[model samples]
Target: MTAETNEVKQTTKGADAVDEAIAQGIDFDGSPIPPAKLELYHKVMALEANRQRSGVSNTMRSRIVRIGAKHIPQAELDKMLIDAGFAPLKDKEAAFFYGGK
Candidate 1:
């Protein structure tokens, strides 16, 4: 805390918001504002927060699963992909993901 930098904008008070978050075992990375303390918005924010914290890209397997679960027929799936700018795998099977993983 002794170390000082140009970037650290000092608050009016000696303490900062980070102090409170740390007290609550939270990590705050400024992003889209949380919707509200309301139950539904809180749930939405929790899901968003988890997704952001994971820092993982959606995988081809997951996408394929989602597509299959939708129960769209093959022809419709093909057209949807095309419309969404997805193309077939260049050298592999004809499945996986929205954008043709």
Candidate 2:
């Protein structure tokens, strides 16, 4: 198989493995998921899936801010947001996400 085909197969296999584990209520470490916790998670996710969205850009920005703060330096993340034409990090976000970093 071509490299791209091999990569796709590997990714499919990985996703299938994860889906199977989830369906079996098994965590990656092989522990059984708590039924209550899983039920709550499913309920919340169902609600979120049905919720109306403002726009794709708004969602993108929110995700970038939420996740990027955990991995990127504050200054870099702010620059990236601005460079991408999104709002720079707000004072609250800066304080909350990068406070002790």
Candidate 3:
């Protein structure tokens, strides 16, 4: 198979493994989703709901950006920034000083 195809297969396998583990009740080493996290999720959902009610676009990228701006995951934040026509930087130094790179 081509390299691209192999990479896709590997990613699919990894996702499947994760799904299977979850289905089998395998608990990965991490704290449970905290109340603050849930609150953030709710806040994001509420924002989306407001946008939808106001006939605005409810794009996932926009939602992610809004959430990320509130200090969500870096990778997710980077993706949101990219989707919003901003560059995704590798580190805080780049994001702060260079405005993403």
Candidate 2 lowest-lDDT run of ten: 6-15
Model 1 TM-score, all chains together: 0.26
Which one wins on TM-score? 2
Local accuracy of candidate 3 as per-residue lDDT tens digits, 1-101: 67744543454444365454344333233224466655676678779667635323445444545445556656666776777776564565346533543
Better of 2 and 3 by TM-score: 2
Tens-place lDDT per residue, model 1, 1-39, is 333322233322343665544333333442223334344
Off by over 4 Å in 2: 1-21
Q: What is the C-alpha local distance difference test score of candidate 1?
A: 0.46
lDDT of 2 at 56: 99
Per lDDT, the best of the predicted structures is 2
Q: Each candidate's lDDT (Cα)?
A: 0.46, 0.83, 0.53
Q: Give the total clashing residue pairs for model 3.
A: 0
Question: Which of the two candidates, 2 or 3, achieves a greater lDDT against the reference?
Answer: 2
Which window of ten consecutive residues has the lowest lDDT sum in model 3? 22-31
TM-score of 3: 0.26
User: What local lDDT does model 2 show for residue 20?
Assistant: 63
TM-score of each: 0.26, 0.75, 0.26
